[model samples]
Target chain A: MTGTGSISDIEPRLGYSLRVNGRDHEVDGAWVGDSLLRVLRDRLGLSGSKNACEQGECGSCSVRLDGRLVCSCLVLAATAVGREITTIEGIAPEDGLTDVQDAMVTEGAVQCGFCTPGLVMAIHDLLDRNPAPTALETREAISGNLCRCTGYGRIFAAVDSTVASRRDAAS
Target chain B: MSVAIPETLEEALQVAAADPEVQVLAGGTDLMVEVNFGYRRPASVCALHRIAELHAQRQDDGEVVIGAMTTYHDMERGVIAAALPGLAQAGRTVGSPQIRNAGTVGGNLATASPAGDTLPVLMALDSTVVVASVAGRREVPISDFLVGPKRNALGPGELIVEVRVPHLRGPQEFLKVGARNAMVIAVCSLALVVDLERRRVACALGSVGPTVLRAFEAEERAAQEIDWQTGRLGDPAFAPEFGRLVAAAARPIDDHRSTAGYRRHAIGVLAERALRRSA
Candidate 1:
C-alpha cells in the first residue's frame, strides 16, 4: 500500500488500541485506509471473522459493534478505536462450542464452512434479540450470510433445533 | 491520510469546515464500498459516528426530526415507524440486518443513489434535509437535496445534521420491484402517501429516473378523484390513470439491473399497487 506521500511522510504508521473479545490490544503501524476486518485478521491475529466480500454485501465479516451486528469490512479501523467489538471467536464458551455452533455441526450445516463464523454471529444476534424467531425471521436475519452449500435448509434446521433445545432447557 | 473522530457536532463541523476536502464518514456503508473497490481514496476523513448530536431523534409538533446517524434498524421500529410507516417500510427493505445496523439514513441521503430504497419515501413525505457547516445550517427540501444520480445538494464543508419529515395523519405505502426478495437493489420503486388533513395524495418514484421523481400530475389527479371522507378512489378508473401518469413522469435508462422498458412498466404497476393498497 503506497502512501499519499504528504500524509504518510509525517507518519507512515498510525497506532491505536481496540477492545476485542473482552480484551484490549494495541495496534501499531497500520495504514489509515485499513478496515477493521483487515486489522483484525492481519494485525490482531484474530481470524474468526472471514473476509469474503470486502464490501458490505456479504456478511462473512459480521461482528458485533457495541452489541449490534455489523459488517467489520465496512467499519474503518480508526473509527472503531473505543467501541466494544465481539467477533465469532468471542462467542464461544471457555471449554465448549456455543449452542448455535453445536447445532450447526449436528445438523450438517457446516458443509463449506466458509460462512459459518458469520452465520454463527448473525444467528447469535437473532436469538439474543428474539429467542423464538419464526422461519421467515430466521431467514431474514441471516440473509446477508450467503452459503453456496447446504441450500440453507440445514442452517434453518439448526437454528430451529437450537431454539427448541434452549426453550426445553429453560423450562 | 489523516483521520479525526470528533465526539461533538461542533467539533466535527469545525474540522470539516477547516478542510473542505475532508471526507465525512457516517456509518461508512457507502464510502467503504468505494474504498474497498479502489474507487475512492480520501486523503483525509472526519468520522461522525462519535458525535452525539448526529445520532439523536426528537418530535416537534407533528414532525419527526430524525438525526442523520439514525440507522435503518432504528427506522424499522418505535416512534419513527409509527409516524412514517412508508419510511419504515422502505427502511426495512434496505440491504440486510448487518448492513441495516451500520447504514445510516444520512448516509443513504448523502450517497443519493437513484436506487436508494428510502429516497422515494422521503420525497413522498416532503422531507427536509438539514445540513450544517461551521458557518451555520440550512434546510433543503428532499427534491432539491437530490440533484442527480449518486449526487446531492450538500455543499463544501457541509454535513447532514438530520432529516425533518412531517408526521401526517394518513395512510402511506412503499413498494419496490427488485431482482429478489432480500439483499437486492430496487429495479423500480414507488411510495404513495395520502394526507387526510390536507386532503392530498403524493407519490414518488425511485430507480426509474435520474433522481427520485415525484408524480405531480398523478398526485393531482388522485387528489381530485379520491373521496376524502371514505379515503377511497372516487372512480376505479383513476387507479390506472394514476399509474399511467406516474410512469410518464419517470425517465429511466437501461442499466445492468433492468431495462428501461421494464423499469417503466414496473413503476406503473408499483404506483398502481401502492395507490390501491393505501386506499
Candidate 2:
C-alpha cells in the first residue's frame, strides 16, 4: 500500500457510507480505488465473502448489491455508497442455517469450502429468481461459481435436495 | 484518486470536459478487471451508473435506441431481445449472470476488444454509435467506430451515449467459438444479418481480425446467390464458397487461445452455419 507519489498522494481518502447486511457503517479510510470485496473483508470484518479471483471471471466473491447478484471484487466500494449489500453472512437467520446451507451440508456439497459462501449466495439468488429450477437451470445458475475441488456433482445434488425440500414444505 | 458519480449525463460530460484524463466507468466489467489485476491505475474515474439518461431505452420508428449503459442482463430479456435477437444471443454468451448484470453494451464497445461478442452483431446489423461531449453529439457507424483491437473512434472527453440499430425484416444469427461454454473469450465469431426488403445479406467476423470485419465479397455473393422470395440459397455449392470467401477476408494472427489457421477455418464454419441458420 505504498503511495508512489502518484495522483493518490494529491487526493485525500474519502468517506463512504454503506448499508451491509441491514447494518449501516461509514468507511472513513476507504480509498477511492478500493473494491467492495476489500471493504467487506478488511474494513467491515465480513470475511464470509471469499476473494478467490479479483477479476470478474471467478464468482467466489459474489454478493447482492441493490438485489442484483454481482462479483463484489468487480464493484468499486466508492460506487457502493448508499446501496444495500447482502453478503453470505446475511443469508441465514441468527439461530440457524439457511435452506441452501442446510442442503449443502446434507448433500456433502462443500469440499475445501473455499467456494461455499459464493455458491450459497448464488444458489440463494437462483432459487429466489426461479423457485422450481430444473436440473439444467440449477447448473446454469451456479455456472459462475467455480469449485476447483471438482465437487459439481454434490453441488447439483444439494440444489436438487433444496428444491425438493422446499416443495415438500410448500405442500 | 477520486470517483465522480454524475447523476446526469450533462454533469458527466462536464466532468469529462474538465478532466480529459478521467476514465469513464460504466459497468466496470472490463475496467475494474484491469484495476484489480493492477493493469490500470487511473487518476480519476467518472462512473455513469447514476446518470439515468445512459440507462434508458426507447423505440423510434423501426430503430431501437439502446442507452450505452444498459446492462447485458436487460438486453437479453427486454425489448432489446425482440428488436435484435442476434445481439441478445451475443449478450447471453457474455460471462455469467453476475457479469451480465454488470457488463454493459457501452463498455463493450468502448473496450473494442477483438473478441468482443457484441461487436460482430452490431456490425452485421449496421448499428450506429452515438457519442457526446461538451462540443456536441455525433453518430458513427459501428464499422467506423471500432478502429482496431482495444481502440475506438472516441475523442478526448467524448462518451458514448447510445447505440442505434435498425429493425430489419429478416432473421439474424450470431455464433461464437470459445474454449468453454461460459465466461470464455471467443476464439472467433461470426454474425449474419439478412434484409429481405432490400434483398441484402451481410456477415461480420469477430476475433479473426484486428477489428470486427465485414465479409464484403461473401455478403455480395450470398446476396446474389440466395433467392430473396424464399429466403434460401439457390445453389447449395454457394454456401461453402461463401464461407471460404468470408474466411479469406479475415486477417487473423496466431495467439494463445487459437492459431491463425484454426481461426480462419473456424470463421468459415461459423459463417456458413450463420448463413444457413438465417436462411
Candidate 3:
C-alpha cells in the first residue's frame, strides 16, 4: 500500500489518511497543493496549530512528524500520508496544561498567545531531547519560535522553571 | 494535480523520466515556500524523501558517500558531522532546528542558490555530486554541478543520489556574515579546507558570485605559505594576502541583502577570519 488510502471519488487530486494525535483520519477533497497546516486545521479540524506565516519563517505552524519538529506550512498534506503527526492539541494532557504549558502560564510567557502553541511544542521537544538544557541551549532550541509579546524574557524563565520542577519531581 | 511518493530510487527516476516537468520535493524548505506564495503551481510533484536509498550514507576507502536525502539535522551531529566538520558547521547555520530536520542536502544542491550554506563547504571538500536517471548514473564535480545562481546541471530525468567527499585530514573552517546569527541567509561566506595529506589548501567563497567560486590564487598562495607538518601558515601576513586574492575572485552584485562592494569586503574579511580560525 502506498498508504495514501484512497483517492477522492469526486475529485482527482485528493484523499489520504494521516495518523494524527494517535488517530487515523481520512482526509478527503484537500487540494494537492494544500499544506499540512491547512489540512490539519481545515480538514481535520485541529485548529490548535496556528497559521501565521504560510512560509516556514514563522513557527506558528510547527508540528511533530514522527517526533521531529517541522513547520507544517512547509509540509505537503498528501506527502504526509502514513506519517505520525502530533500537534499542540495532542500535546496537552486530558485535563490540564502540561508542565511546560503550566510553566508558561505561571511565568507570563504568553502575551498575545499566537506564538504560544509553537513555543510550547518547541519547548517540549527541547526538554525531551535534553532534560537539562542550559540557558543558551534552551534559547538556541527555540530560536526558530519567535514571540513578539513578553520580549522572550518570560519565555526563558518559563523554560528554566520547567527544567527545575522536572528535576525536583525526579528527585 | 498528482503526487508520486516513490519508494525506490528506480521508481523515482521512472516517475521523473515519464514526466520531466514533475516538481521534486525533498525537504520542502525552498520549494514549499514557492508553493505557499503561489509562485509555482506544480501540476505534479515527485516526493523523494520516502526512498530509503536516498537517505543512506557510508564510508568507503578514503571518502564519505552521503545520500542526497540526508537532512541538515543529520549533518548537525554524529558520524557525518565528525567526518565533515565544515559541512556540519555550514549545516548548523541553516534556518532552524525545524528547518534542519526537514531540509535535505540534495535540496540545497538542487536549488543551487548562491547563498546555499552547504555549497562552499562541498566545493572546498573537493566533493562530487552523483546524479542518476533511468539510463545510468554520472558523477559531476561540485564546481560543474553548480552551474550558476539558483541553477544546476541536473538533466530532465536526473536526480542527485549522493555526494562523495574526502574525509577531513586536517583543520577546516566555514564562516559567513549574516544579518543575524540564526535563521538568516548569508550575505557572504567562506569555506577553508586544509588537506594535510595532500599538502594543499582550498577555499571557496559563497553569496559573492553567481556560483560558489574557488579562490584559486588564494589556494595556490596559501598552499605554499603553510607548513603542512604543523598545519600553520609560514608567514602571518599570508592570511590577509590570501583574503585579498579571494575577494578579487568574486563577482558580487548589489542585491537587497548586501551591496556588491560590501560583499567583496565582507568576503575578504571572512576569508582572513576563516584562515586564522583554522590556524
Candidate 3 lDDT tens digits, B48-142: 98899899888888998999999999998876788899999999999888999999999999999999999999999889999999999999999
Q: List, residue by residue over A1-171, the lDDT tens digit for candidate 2.
A: 476787656565879789999999889876677889999999999999998889887799999999999999999888887789999999899989999999999989988999999999999999999999988888778888999985599999888899899999999
Clashing pairs in 2: B1-B43
Residue A156 error, candidate 1, Å: 0.4
- A34-110, model 1: which lDDT tens digit per residue? 89999999999999899988988779999999999999999989889899999998989888899999999999999
Poorest stretch of ten by lDDT in candidate 3 chain B: B227-236
Encode model 1's per-residue lDDT on B1-279: one tens digit a residue: 578998899998899889999988998988998887778877788998988878877889989999999999999998888889998999899889998998899999999999999999999999999999988999999999999999999999899999999999989999999977778899999999999999999999999989999999989999999899899988877888788999999999999999999999999999888888877
Runs in model 2 with CA error above 4 Å?
A1-11
Each candidate structure's TM-score, on Cα atoms with residue i matched to residue i, is 0.97, 0.97, 0.96
Error of 2 at B135 (Å): 1.8
- In the range B1-279, model 2's lDDT, one tens digit per residue, is 578998999999999999999989899889888888878877688999988888988889999999999998988877889888989999988889889999999999999999998999999989999999999999999999999999999999999999999988898898999988889899999999999999999899999999999999999999999888799889777888888999999999999999999999999999888887777
In candidate 1, which residue ranges exceed 4 Å CA deviation?
Answer: A1-12
Better of 2 and 3 by DockQ: 2
What lDDT score goes with residue B132 in model 2? 97
B272: Cα error in model 1, Å: 0.8
Model 3 chain A scores worst on lDDT over the 10 consecutive residues at A3-12
lDDT of 1 at B4: 94
Candidate 2 docks with a DockQ of 0.69
TM-score of chain B of each: 0.98, 0.98, 0.98
Reference-based lDDT, residue A45, model 2: 96
Looking at model 2 chain A, report the run of 10 residues with the lowest lDDT sum: A1-10
